[model samples]
Target: MHERHTAKARRRRGQRLYLLIVLVLAGGLAWLQISRIHSAAGVVSGQQIAAPKEGFLAPEIQFTGLDGQPHALSEFKGHPIILNFWATWCPPCRGEMPALEAVYKAYAADGLLIIGVNQMEDSGKVSRFQEQFHLTFPIFLDKQGQAGATYRARGLPSSFFIDQKGFIRKIVVGGMNEPLIQGQVSALLGKE
Candidate 1:
Protein backbone atom coordinates (compact mmCIF):
# COMPACT_ATOMS: atom_id res chain seq x y z
CA MET A 1 0.00 0.00 0.00
CA HIS A 2 2.79 2.38 0.93
CA GLU A 3 4.65 1.71 -2.35
CA ARG A 4 1.48 2.19 -4.39
CA HIS A 5 0.80 5.54 -2.67
CA THR A 6 4.31 6.75 -3.42
CA ALA A 7 4.00 5.82 -7.11
CA LYS A 8 0.68 7.63 -7.41
CA ALA A 9 2.16 10.76 -5.88
CA ARG A 10 5.09 10.59 -8.33
CA ARG A 11 2.71 10.28 -11.25
CA ARG A 12 0.74 13.25 -10.04
CA ARG A 13 3.90 15.33 -9.69
CA GLY A 14 4.96 14.38 -13.21
CA GLN A 15 1.57 15.34 -14.62
CA ARG A 16 1.69 18.66 -12.84
CA LEU A 17 5.14 19.34 -14.19
CA TYR A 18 4.04 18.55 -17.73
CA LEU A 19 1.07 20.89 -17.46
CA LEU A 20 3.31 23.64 -16.15
CA ILE A 21 5.65 23.27 -19.12
CA VAL A 22 2.77 23.45 -21.61
CA LEU A 23 1.39 26.57 -19.95
CA VAL A 24 4.79 28.27 -20.01
CA LEU A 25 5.23 27.48 -23.68
CA ALA A 26 1.78 28.80 -24.52
CA GLY A 27 2.43 32.01 -22.61
CA GLY A 28 5.71 32.51 -24.45
CA LEU A 29 4.04 32.05 -27.83
CA ALA A 30 1.29 34.51 -26.90
CA TRP A 31 3.84 37.08 -25.87
CA LEU A 32 5.70 36.66 -29.15
CA GLN A 33 2.49 37.08 -31.16
CA ILE A 34 1.51 40.22 -29.26
CA SER A 35 4.96 41.69 -29.83
CA ARG A 36 4.72 40.95 -33.54
CA ILE A 37 1.29 42.61 -33.83
CA HIS A 38 2.58 45.68 -32.02
CA SER A 39 5.57 45.86 -34.36
CA ALA A 40 3.42 45.52 -37.47
CA ALA A 41 1.00 48.09 -36.15
CA GLY A 42 3.83 50.53 -35.72
CA VAL A 43 5.15 49.93 -39.22
CA VAL A 44 1.83 50.51 -41.05
CA SER A 45 0.78 53.62 -39.15
CA GLY A 46 3.15 55.84 -41.11
CA GLN A 47 2.24 57.78 -44.25
CA GLN A 48 3.83 55.28 -46.59
CA ILE A 49 1.82 52.45 -48.07
CA ALA A 50 2.50 48.88 -46.94
CA ALA A 51 2.53 46.56 -49.92
CA PRO A 52 4.63 43.76 -51.35
CA LYS A 53 7.87 44.83 -52.95
CA GLU A 54 6.30 44.36 -56.39
CA GLY A 55 5.32 47.58 -58.10
CA PHE A 56 1.69 48.76 -58.05
CA LEU A 57 0.49 49.49 -61.55
CA ALA A 58 -2.32 48.85 -63.93
CA PRO A 59 -2.85 45.11 -63.92
CA GLU A 60 -5.26 44.03 -66.62
CA ILE A 61 -7.66 42.31 -64.24
CA GLN A 62 -11.22 41.78 -65.49
CA PHE A 63 -13.41 39.80 -63.12
CA THR A 64 -17.12 39.13 -62.86
CA GLY A 65 -18.74 41.58 -60.49
CA LEU A 66 -21.82 40.95 -58.37
CA ASP A 67 -23.83 42.47 -61.18
CA GLY A 68 -22.09 40.25 -63.75
CA GLN A 69 -20.12 43.11 -65.27
CA PRO A 70 -16.36 42.91 -65.77
CA HIS A 71 -14.58 45.31 -63.47
CA ALA A 72 -11.02 46.52 -63.05
CA LEU A 73 -9.14 48.23 -60.26
CA SER A 74 -7.73 50.93 -62.49
CA GLU A 75 -11.14 52.49 -62.93
CA PHE A 76 -11.19 53.36 -59.23
CA LYS A 77 -7.90 55.21 -59.27
CA GLY A 78 -7.64 58.86 -58.21
CA HIS A 79 -9.45 57.78 -55.02
CA PRO A 80 -8.64 56.16 -51.73
CA ILE A 81 -9.43 52.44 -51.97
CA ILE A 82 -9.89 49.75 -49.40
CA LEU A 83 -9.15 46.43 -51.03
CA ASN A 84 -10.21 43.42 -48.96
CA PHE A 85 -9.24 39.84 -49.81
CA TRP A 86 -11.71 37.38 -48.41
CA ALA A 87 -13.55 34.12 -49.11
CA THR A 88 -17.15 33.06 -48.68
CA TRP A 89 -16.20 30.43 -46.11
CA CYS A 90 -14.26 32.62 -43.72
CA PRO A 91 -16.40 33.40 -40.66
CA PRO A 92 -14.29 36.37 -39.72
CA CYS A 93 -14.79 37.66 -43.21
CA ARG A 94 -18.52 37.35 -42.80
CA GLY A 95 -18.42 39.19 -39.49
CA GLU A 96 -16.52 42.14 -40.91
CA MET A 97 -18.80 42.67 -43.90
CA PRO A 98 -21.35 44.92 -42.25
CA ALA A 99 -18.72 47.24 -40.87
CA LEU A 100 -17.12 47.46 -44.28
CA GLU A 101 -20.48 48.22 -45.88
CA ALA A 102 -21.20 50.88 -43.30
CA VAL A 103 -17.94 52.59 -44.04
CA TYR A 104 -18.55 52.24 -47.73
CA LYS A 105 -21.89 54.02 -47.51
CA ALA A 106 -20.51 56.70 -45.25
CA TYR A 107 -17.43 57.44 -47.35
CA ALA A 108 -18.43 56.58 -50.91
CA ALA A 109 -19.64 60.13 -51.36
CA ASP A 110 -16.13 61.29 -50.46
CA GLY A 111 -14.33 59.28 -53.14
CA LEU A 112 -13.61 56.40 -50.78
CA LEU A 113 -13.65 53.10 -52.65
CA ILE A 114 -14.16 49.77 -50.90
CA ILE A 115 -13.38 46.78 -53.08
CA GLY A 116 -13.86 43.23 -51.90
CA VAL A 117 -11.61 40.73 -53.61
CA ASN A 118 -13.19 37.29 -53.30
CA GLN A 119 -10.57 34.62 -53.77
CA MET A 120 -10.74 30.98 -54.93
CA GLU A 121 -14.52 30.85 -54.92
CA ASP A 122 -17.02 30.18 -57.64
CA SER A 123 -19.03 33.02 -59.12
CA GLY A 124 -22.24 31.40 -57.95
CA LYS A 125 -21.10 31.24 -54.35
CA VAL A 126 -19.82 34.79 -54.47
CA SER A 127 -23.09 36.02 -55.85
CA ARG A 128 -25.12 34.26 -53.20
CA PHE A 129 -22.99 35.60 -50.37
CA GLN A 130 -23.10 39.11 -51.72
CA GLU A 131 -26.84 39.10 -52.17
CA GLN A 132 -27.44 37.62 -48.74
CA PHE A 133 -25.43 40.33 -47.10
CA HIS A 134 -26.87 43.14 -49.22
CA LEU A 135 -23.32 44.25 -49.92
CA THR A 136 -23.37 47.37 -52.06
CA PHE A 137 -19.60 47.63 -52.41
CA PRO A 138 -18.03 46.26 -55.55
CA ILE A 139 -16.63 42.74 -55.11
CA PHE A 140 -14.05 41.58 -57.60
CA LEU A 141 -13.42 37.93 -58.23
CA ASP A 142 -9.85 36.75 -57.82
CA LYS A 143 -10.69 33.50 -59.54
CA GLN A 144 -7.09 32.39 -59.96
CA GLY A 145 -6.00 33.86 -56.63
CA GLN A 146 -3.11 35.54 -58.45
CA ALA A 147 -3.49 38.95 -56.83
CA GLY A 148 -3.90 37.46 -53.37
CA ALA A 149 -0.73 35.42 -53.84
CA THR A 150 1.16 38.55 -54.83
CA TYR A 151 0.09 40.20 -51.60
CA ARG A 152 1.28 37.10 -49.70
CA ALA A 153 -1.93 37.05 -47.74
CA ARG A 154 -1.11 34.49 -45.08
CA GLY A 155 -4.79 33.94 -44.40
CA LEU A 156 -8.28 35.08 -45.14
CA PRO A 157 -9.79 38.54 -44.67
CA SER A 158 -6.58 40.41 -45.43
CA SER A 159 -7.05 43.99 -46.57
CA PHE A 160 -4.91 46.58 -48.33
CA PHE A 161 -5.55 50.30 -48.08
CA ILE A 162 -4.40 52.22 -51.13
CA ASP A 163 -4.06 55.97 -51.31
CA GLN A 164 -5.14 58.07 -54.26
CA LYS A 165 -1.57 57.94 -55.56
CA GLY A 166 -2.03 54.17 -56.08
CA PHE A 167 0.38 53.34 -53.28
CA ILE A 168 -0.59 50.78 -50.68
CA ARG A 169 -0.68 52.60 -47.36
CA LYS A 170 -1.65 49.75 -45.04
CA ILE A 171 -2.17 45.99 -45.00
CA VAL A 172 -4.57 44.52 -42.44
CA VAL A 173 -4.66 40.78 -41.86
CA GLY A 174 -7.02 38.53 -39.97
CA GLY A 175 -10.38 39.73 -38.67
CA MET A 176 -11.15 43.41 -38.15
CA ASN A 177 -13.82 45.47 -36.44
CA GLU A 178 -15.44 48.78 -37.39
CA PRO A 179 -13.11 50.82 -35.26
CA LEU A 180 -10.06 49.32 -36.91
CA ILE A 181 -11.39 49.84 -40.42
CA GLN A 182 -12.52 53.37 -39.62
CA GLY A 183 -9.21 54.28 -38.06
CA GLN A 184 -7.24 53.01 -41.04
CA VAL A 185 -9.52 54.78 -43.48
CA SER A 186 -9.26 57.94 -41.44
CA ALA A 187 -5.49 57.64 -41.58
CA LEU A 188 -5.48 57.24 -45.35
CA LEU A 189 -8.04 59.99 -45.80
CA GLY A 190 -5.91 62.29 -43.62
CA LYS A 191 -8.93 62.96 -41.44
CA GLU A 192 -8.99 63.40 -37.68
Candidate 2:
Protein backbone atom coordinates (compact mmCIF):
# COMPACT_ATOMS: atom_id res chain seq x y z
CA MET A 1 0.00 0.00 0.00
CA HIS A 2 2.84 2.41 0.81
CA GLU A 3 4.48 1.73 -2.61
CA ARG A 4 1.14 2.44 -4.37
CA HIS A 5 0.79 5.81 -2.56
CA THR A 6 4.35 6.73 -3.44
CA ALA A 7 3.74 5.99 -7.15
CA LYS A 8 0.57 8.12 -7.18
CA ALA A 9 2.35 11.01 -5.47
CA ARG A 10 5.14 10.85 -8.05
CA ARG A 11 2.64 11.04 -10.91
CA ARG A 12 0.85 13.99 -9.32
CA ARG A 13 4.13 15.80 -8.85
CA GLY A 14 5.04 15.27 -12.52
CA GLN A 15 1.67 16.62 -13.62
CA ARG A 16 2.09 19.68 -11.42
CA LEU A 17 5.51 20.32 -12.93
CA TYR A 18 4.08 20.14 -16.45
CA LEU A 19 1.28 22.52 -15.56
CA LEU A 20 3.72 24.96 -13.99
CA ILE A 21 5.90 24.97 -17.11
CA VAL A 22 2.86 25.64 -19.33
CA LEU A 23 1.71 28.53 -17.16
CA VAL A 24 5.16 30.08 -17.18
CA LEU A 25 5.42 29.87 -20.98
CA ALA A 26 1.94 31.31 -21.43
CA GLY A 27 2.72 34.24 -19.14
CA GLY A 28 5.93 34.99 -21.00
CA LEU A 29 4.16 35.00 -24.38
CA ALA A 30 1.41 37.28 -23.04
CA TRP A 31 3.97 39.71 -21.68
CA LEU A 32 5.77 39.83 -25.04
CA GLN A 33 2.52 40.56 -26.91
CA ILE A 34 1.56 43.33 -24.50
CA SER A 35 4.97 44.90 -24.83
CA ARG A 36 4.71 44.94 -28.63
CA ILE A 37 1.24 46.46 -28.46
CA HIS A 38 2.44 49.20 -26.11
CA SER A 39 5.25 50.02 -28.51
CA ALA A 40 2.89 50.12 -31.52
CA ALA A 41 0.40 52.26 -29.58
CA GLY A 42 3.16 54.79 -28.93
CA VAL A 43 3.76 54.99 -32.69
CA VAL A 44 0.02 55.24 -33.42
CA SER A 45 -0.41 57.99 -30.85
CA GLY A 46 2.40 59.87 -32.63
CA GLN A 47 4.35 60.10 -29.41
CA GLN A 48 7.76 58.60 -30.07
CA ILE A 49 8.06 57.30 -33.63
CA ALA A 50 7.58 60.14 -36.12
CA ALA A 51 8.00 57.99 -39.23
CA PRO A 52 8.20 54.38 -40.31
CA LYS A 53 11.21 52.77 -38.65
CA GLU A 54 12.53 51.33 -41.90
CA GLY A 55 12.77 54.80 -43.51
CA PHE A 56 12.35 53.05 -46.83
CA LEU A 57 10.44 54.61 -49.68
CA ALA A 58 6.84 53.61 -50.08
CA PRO A 59 6.46 50.55 -52.32
CA GLU A 60 5.49 51.34 -55.90
CA ILE A 61 1.90 50.35 -56.59
CA GLN A 62 0.30 50.61 -60.01
CA PHE A 63 -3.30 49.64 -60.54
CA THR A 64 -6.33 50.68 -62.54
CA GLY A 65 -8.92 52.82 -60.82
CA LEU A 66 -12.68 52.32 -60.95
CA ASP A 67 -12.81 55.16 -63.45
CA GLY A 68 -10.91 52.84 -65.84
CA GLN A 69 -7.81 54.98 -65.72
CA PRO A 70 -4.33 53.80 -64.78
CA HIS A 71 -3.19 55.04 -61.35
CA ALA A 72 0.15 54.66 -59.72
CA LEU A 73 1.41 55.59 -56.26
CA SER A 74 4.44 57.24 -57.79
CA GLU A 75 2.17 59.54 -59.78
CA PHE A 76 0.86 61.07 -56.57
CA LYS A 77 4.34 61.98 -55.36
CA GLY A 78 3.70 65.71 -55.02
CA HIS A 79 0.70 65.21 -52.74
CA PRO A 80 0.13 63.71 -49.33
CA ILE A 81 -1.42 60.32 -50.04
CA ILE A 82 -3.55 58.09 -47.86
CA LEU A 83 -3.07 54.52 -49.17
CA ASN A 84 -5.85 52.45 -47.71
CA PHE A 85 -6.20 48.65 -48.14
CA TRP A 86 -9.71 47.37 -47.67
CA ALA A 87 -12.24 44.69 -48.68
CA THR A 88 -15.98 44.81 -49.09
CA TRP A 89 -16.53 41.85 -46.75
CA CYS A 90 -14.84 43.53 -43.81
CA PRO A 91 -17.25 45.25 -41.43
CA PRO A 92 -14.73 47.76 -40.06
CA CYS A 93 -13.61 48.66 -43.58
CA ARG A 94 -17.21 49.32 -44.56
CA GLY A 95 -17.89 51.32 -41.40
CA GLU A 96 -14.82 53.51 -41.86
CA MET A 97 -15.51 54.45 -45.50
CA PRO A 98 -17.80 57.34 -44.62
CA ALA A 99 -15.24 58.86 -42.30
CA LEU A 100 -12.54 58.51 -44.95
CA GLU A 101 -14.85 60.03 -47.54
CA ALA A 102 -15.65 62.98 -45.32
CA VAL A 103 -11.98 63.59 -44.63
CA TYR A 104 -11.14 63.29 -48.33
CA LYS A 105 -13.83 65.81 -49.21
CA ALA A 106 -12.64 68.26 -46.58
CA TYR A 107 -8.95 67.96 -47.40
CA ALA A 108 -8.61 67.00 -51.08
CA ALA A 109 -8.17 70.62 -52.15
CA ASP A 110 -5.33 70.89 -49.66
CA GLY A 111 -3.31 68.43 -51.81
CA LEU A 112 -4.38 65.46 -49.75
CA LEU A 113 -5.03 62.41 -51.93
CA ILE A 114 -6.87 59.37 -50.59
CA ILE A 115 -6.44 56.13 -52.54
CA GLY A 116 -8.70 53.24 -51.67
CA VAL A 117 -7.06 49.92 -52.64
CA ASN A 118 -9.75 47.29 -52.95
CA GLN A 119 -8.62 43.70 -52.38
CA MET A 120 -9.63 41.11 -54.99
CA GLU A 121 -13.22 42.28 -55.37
CA ASP A 122 -15.30 42.75 -58.50
CA SER A 123 -15.89 46.20 -59.93
CA GLY A 124 -19.61 45.87 -59.39
CA LYS A 125 -19.27 45.39 -55.63
CA VAL A 126 -16.70 48.13 -55.34
CA SER A 127 -18.75 50.47 -57.49
CA ARG A 128 -21.85 49.81 -55.38
CA PHE A 129 -19.95 50.43 -52.14
CA GLN A 130 -18.46 53.63 -53.50
CA GLU A 131 -21.86 54.79 -54.63
CA GLN A 132 -23.40 53.84 -51.32
CA PHE A 133 -20.86 55.84 -49.38
CA HIS A 134 -20.57 58.52 -52.07
CA LEU A 135 -16.81 58.22 -51.78
CA THR A 136 -15.24 60.43 -54.42
CA PHE A 137 -11.70 59.32 -53.75
CA PRO A 138 -10.05 57.13 -56.33
CA ILE A 139 -10.60 53.41 -55.74
CA PHE A 140 -7.94 51.11 -57.16
CA LEU A 141 -8.49 47.44 -57.94
CA ASP A 142 -5.95 45.08 -56.39
CA LYS A 143 -7.24 42.12 -58.36
CA GLN A 144 -4.41 39.80 -57.38
CA GLY A 145 -3.96 41.31 -53.91
CA GLN A 146 -0.48 42.39 -54.96
CA ALA A 147 -0.79 45.75 -53.25
CA GLY A 148 -1.78 44.17 -49.96
CA ALA A 149 1.12 41.73 -50.17
CA THR A 150 3.57 44.51 -51.06
CA TYR A 151 2.44 46.55 -48.07
CA ARG A 152 2.52 43.45 -45.83
CA ALA A 153 -1.03 44.25 -44.81
CA ARG A 154 -2.33 41.45 -42.58
CA GLY A 155 -5.67 43.04 -41.81
CA LEU A 156 -8.42 44.86 -43.63
CA PRO A 157 -8.56 48.67 -43.56
CA SER A 158 -4.81 49.05 -43.18
CA SER A 159 -3.65 52.56 -44.12
CA PHE A 160 -0.37 54.25 -44.92
CA PHE A 161 -0.10 58.02 -44.67
CA ILE A 162 2.54 59.24 -47.08
CA ASP A 163 3.99 62.71 -47.14
CA GLN A 164 4.28 64.89 -50.21
CA LYS A 165 7.88 63.75 -50.67
CA GLY A 166 6.63 60.18 -51.30
CA PHE A 167 7.89 58.85 -47.99
CA ILE A 168 5.72 56.82 -45.69
CA ARG A 169 4.96 58.84 -42.56
CA LYS A 170 2.59 56.62 -40.65
CA ILE A 171 0.78 53.28 -40.95
CA VAL A 172 -2.53 52.45 -39.28
CA VAL A 173 -3.50 48.75 -39.17
CA GLY A 174 -7.18 48.98 -38.36
CA GLY A 175 -10.27 51.06 -38.82
CA MET A 176 -9.89 54.82 -38.37
CA ASN A 177 -12.46 57.40 -37.25
CA GLU A 178 -12.54 61.01 -38.39
CA PRO A 179 -10.40 62.38 -35.57
CA LEU A 180 -7.79 59.68 -35.96
CA ILE A 181 -7.72 60.18 -39.71
CA GLN A 182 -7.43 63.94 -39.24
CA GLY A 183 -4.61 63.58 -36.75
CA GLN A 184 -2.61 61.38 -39.11
CA VAL A 185 -3.45 63.67 -42.04
CA SER A 186 -2.26 66.64 -40.04
CA ALA A 187 1.00 64.88 -39.38
CA LEU A 188 1.34 63.97 -43.03
CA LEU A 189 0.69 67.61 -43.99
CA GLY A 190 3.47 68.72 -41.60
CA LYS A 191 0.92 70.59 -39.52
CA GLU A 192 1.83 68.62 -36.43
Candidate 3:
Protein backbone atom coordinates (compact mmCIF):
# COMPACT_ATOMS: atom_id res chain seq x y z
CA MET A 1 0.00 0.00 0.00
CA HIS A 2 2.91 2.40 0.93
CA GLU A 3 4.66 1.55 -2.33
CA ARG A 4 1.55 2.44 -4.35
CA HIS A 5 1.22 5.79 -2.50
CA THR A 6 4.83 6.68 -3.20
CA ALA A 7 4.42 5.81 -6.87
CA LYS A 8 1.34 8.07 -7.15
CA ALA A 9 3.14 11.01 -5.52
CA ARG A 10 6.10 10.66 -7.92
CA ARG A 11 3.76 10.56 -10.91
CA ARG A 12 1.94 13.66 -9.69
CA ARG A 13 5.17 15.60 -9.27
CA GLY A 14 6.32 14.57 -12.73
CA GLN A 15 3.02 15.69 -14.23
CA ARG A 16 3.28 19.05 -12.47
CA LEU A 17 6.80 19.56 -13.76
CA TYR A 18 5.72 18.82 -17.31
CA LEU A 19 2.79 21.20 -17.01
CA LEU A 20 5.03 23.99 -15.70
CA ILE A 21 7.42 23.56 -18.62
CA VAL A 22 4.56 23.78 -21.11
CA LEU A 23 3.21 26.94 -19.51
CA VAL A 24 6.59 28.61 -19.56
CA LEU A 25 7.04 27.86 -23.24
CA ALA A 26 3.60 29.16 -24.05
CA GLY A 27 4.23 32.38 -22.12
CA GLY A 28 7.51 32.99 -23.90
CA LEU A 29 5.93 32.52 -27.31
CA ALA A 30 3.12 34.87 -26.39
CA TRP A 31 5.54 37.57 -25.31
CA LEU A 32 7.55 37.23 -28.51
CA GLN A 33 4.43 37.57 -30.64
CA ILE A 34 3.39 40.68 -28.76
CA SER A 35 6.77 42.27 -29.28
CA ARG A 36 6.61 41.62 -33.01
CA ILE A 37 3.16 43.15 -33.21
CA HIS A 38 4.29 46.29 -31.42
CA SER A 39 7.23 46.63 -33.78
CA ALA A 40 4.85 46.73 -36.77
CA ALA A 41 3.07 49.80 -35.42
CA GLY A 42 3.07 53.09 -37.33
CA VAL A 43 1.69 56.58 -36.81
CA VAL A 44 -1.44 56.74 -34.72
CA SER A 45 -3.22 59.40 -36.74
CA GLY A 46 -6.64 58.82 -38.19
CA GLN A 47 -5.26 58.84 -41.72
CA GLN A 48 -4.38 55.68 -43.58
CA ILE A 49 -0.95 54.98 -42.17
CA ALA A 50 1.18 52.46 -43.98
CA ALA A 51 3.94 50.16 -42.73
CA PRO A 52 6.92 52.52 -43.25
CA LYS A 53 7.98 52.44 -46.89
CA GLU A 54 8.86 54.65 -49.80
CA GLY A 55 6.25 57.09 -51.14
CA PHE A 56 4.48 56.86 -47.78
CA LEU A 57 4.62 59.16 -44.81
CA ALA A 58 7.49 58.08 -42.63
CA PRO A 59 6.16 56.63 -39.41
CA GLU A 60 6.41 58.85 -36.38
CA ILE A 61 9.51 58.22 -34.31
CA GLN A 62 9.88 59.47 -30.73
CA PHE A 63 13.11 58.92 -28.83
CA THR A 64 15.49 60.71 -26.51
CA GLY A 65 18.89 61.89 -27.63
CA LEU A 66 22.10 61.07 -25.82
CA ASP A 67 21.62 64.38 -24.05
CA GLY A 68 18.32 63.02 -22.67
CA GLN A 69 16.30 65.49 -24.67
CA PRO A 70 13.07 64.21 -26.20
CA HIS A 71 12.70 64.24 -29.98
CA ALA A 72 10.30 63.11 -32.64
CA LEU A 73 10.23 62.92 -36.43
CA SER A 74 7.17 65.16 -36.66
CA GLU A 75 9.09 68.10 -35.23
CA PHE A 76 11.46 68.07 -38.24
CA LYS A 77 8.77 67.87 -40.89
CA GLY A 78 9.63 71.19 -42.53
CA HIS A 79 13.27 70.20 -43.10
CA PRO A 80 14.93 67.57 -45.28
CA ILE A 81 15.83 64.58 -43.13
CA ILE A 82 18.20 61.68 -43.48
CA LEU A 83 16.86 59.21 -40.89
CA ASN A 84 19.72 56.81 -40.30
CA PHE A 85 19.46 53.73 -38.05
CA TRP A 86 22.74 52.47 -36.69
CA ALA A 87 24.55 50.85 -33.77
CA THR A 88 28.04 51.22 -32.36
CA TRP A 89 28.58 47.47 -32.44
CA CYS A 90 27.79 47.21 -36.15
CA PRO A 91 30.87 47.43 -38.39
CA PRO A 92 28.86 48.74 -41.31
CA CYS A 93 27.32 51.40 -39.13
CA ARG A 94 30.74 52.47 -37.92
CA GLY A 95 32.00 52.47 -41.49
CA GLU A 96 29.38 55.01 -42.57
CA MET A 97 29.70 57.47 -39.69
CA PRO A 98 32.35 59.62 -41.34
CA ALA A 99 30.37 59.81 -44.55
CA LEU A 100 27.27 60.75 -42.62
CA GLU A 101 29.21 63.38 -40.74
CA ALA A 102 30.53 64.80 -43.98
CA VAL A 103 27.05 64.97 -45.40
CA TYR A 104 25.77 66.72 -42.30
CA LYS A 105 28.55 69.28 -42.44
CA ALA A 106 28.09 69.85 -46.15
CA TYR A 107 24.36 70.45 -45.88
CA ALA A 108 23.86 72.05 -42.47
CA ALA A 109 23.63 75.48 -44.04
CA ASP A 110 21.07 74.13 -46.49
CA GLY A 111 18.75 72.96 -43.68
CA LEU A 112 19.53 69.26 -44.10
CA LEU A 113 19.18 67.21 -40.91
CA ILE A 114 20.88 63.85 -40.50
CA ILE A 115 19.26 62.14 -37.53
CA GLY A 116 21.04 59.04 -36.30
CA VAL A 117 19.00 56.45 -34.42
CA ASN A 118 21.16 54.07 -32.47
CA GLN A 119 19.71 50.73 -31.50
CA MET A 120 19.60 49.55 -27.88
CA GLU A 121 22.97 50.52 -26.42
CA ASP A 122 24.55 52.40 -23.57
CA SER A 123 24.49 56.20 -23.77
CA GLY A 124 28.16 56.51 -22.84
CA LYS A 125 29.19 54.06 -25.54
CA VAL A 126 27.20 55.97 -28.14
CA SER A 127 28.75 59.24 -27.06
CA ARG A 128 32.24 57.77 -27.30
CA PHE A 129 31.48 56.35 -30.71
CA GLN A 130 30.25 59.75 -31.87
CA GLU A 131 33.42 61.34 -30.59
CA GLN A 132 35.50 58.73 -32.36
CA PHE A 133 33.72 59.38 -35.66
CA HIS A 134 33.41 63.14 -35.09
CA LEU A 135 29.72 62.98 -35.92
CA THR A 136 28.04 66.32 -35.30
CA PHE A 137 24.53 65.43 -36.35
CA PRO A 138 21.85 64.48 -33.87
CA ILE A 139 21.97 60.94 -32.48
CA PHE A 140 18.86 59.60 -30.75
CA LEU A 141 18.99 56.56 -28.52
CA ASP A 142 16.48 53.86 -29.28
CA LYS A 143 16.61 52.30 -25.83
CA GLN A 144 13.84 49.80 -26.48
CA GLY A 145 14.68 49.22 -30.16
CA GLN A 146 11.31 50.82 -30.91
CA ALA A 147 12.59 53.22 -33.56
CA GLY A 148 14.78 50.63 -35.21
CA ALA A 149 12.02 48.04 -35.33
CA THR A 150 9.47 50.64 -36.39
CA TYR A 151 11.72 51.72 -39.25
CA ARG A 152 12.21 48.08 -40.19
CA ALA A 153 15.94 48.45 -39.93
CA ARG A 154 16.76 44.77 -40.17
CA GLY A 155 20.26 45.53 -41.39
CA LEU A 156 22.89 47.90 -40.07
CA PRO A 157 23.28 51.41 -41.51
CA SER A 158 19.74 51.49 -42.91
CA SER A 159 18.70 54.94 -44.02
CA PHE A 160 15.57 56.72 -45.13
CA PHE A 161 15.62 59.90 -47.15
CA ILE A 162 12.66 61.98 -46.04
CA ASP A 163 11.55 65.08 -47.88
CA GLN A 164 10.46 68.31 -46.27
CA LYS A 165 6.86 67.14 -46.44
CA GLY A 166 7.65 64.05 -44.30
CA PHE A 167 7.40 61.56 -47.12
CA ILE A 168 9.99 58.81 -47.35
CA ARG A 169 11.57 59.49 -50.70
CA LYS A 170 13.97 56.58 -50.59
CA ILE A 171 14.85 53.66 -48.34
CA VAL A 172 18.30 52.10 -48.50
CA VAL A 173 19.53 49.19 -46.42
CA GLY A 174 23.17 48.46 -45.53
CA GLY A 175 25.97 51.01 -45.54
CA MET A 176 25.97 54.23 -47.59
CA ASN A 177 28.87 56.02 -49.26
CA GLU A 178 29.48 59.74 -49.52
CA PRO A 179 28.24 60.05 -53.09
CA LEU A 180 25.16 57.92 -52.40
CA ILE A 181 24.28 59.94 -49.30
CA GLN A 182 25.00 63.23 -51.04
CA GLY A 183 22.90 62.21 -54.04
CA GLN A 184 20.01 61.29 -51.80
CA VAL A 185 20.34 64.54 -49.91
CA SER A 186 20.43 66.47 -53.16
CA ALA A 187 17.32 64.73 -54.36
CA LEU A 188 15.59 65.40 -51.04
CA LEU A 189 16.49 69.05 -51.36
CA GLY A 190 15.29 69.09 -55.00
CA LYS A 191 18.83 69.95 -56.05
CA GLU A 192 19.24 66.75 -58.03
- What are the lDDT figures for the candidates, one per model? 0.81, 0.85, 0.87
Look at candidate 2 and tell me the lDDT of residue 9.
100
Identify the leading candidate in terms of lDDT: 3
lDDT of 1 by residue, 34-151 (tens): 7775555445444244345322432334456765677777788899988888998999999999999999998988899998999988888998999999999988888788878777
Per-residue C-alpha lDDT of model 2 across residues 1-192, encoded as one tens digit per residue? 999999999999999999999999999999988777555644554443233322346778777787678777888888998999999999999989999999999898899999999999988999998898898998999988887888888888899888776667788889999999999998787777
Instruction: Write model 3 residue lDDT over 46-162, tens digit each, in one string.
Output: 124545788778899898879899888888889999999999888888888899999899999999999999899989999999888888998899999998888889988899998
Find the 10 residues in a row with the least total lDDT in model 1. Answer: 53-62
Question: Could you tell which candidate, 2 or 3, scores higher by lDDT?
Answer: 3
- Candidate 3 segments whose C-alpha is farther than 4 A from its true place: 1-50
After TM-score superposition, what is the CA distance of residue 94 in candidate 3 from its true location, in Å? 0.7
Poorly placed runs, candidate 1 (over 4 Å): 1-62, 67-69
TM-score of each: 0.68, 0.71, 0.73
TM-score of 3: 0.73
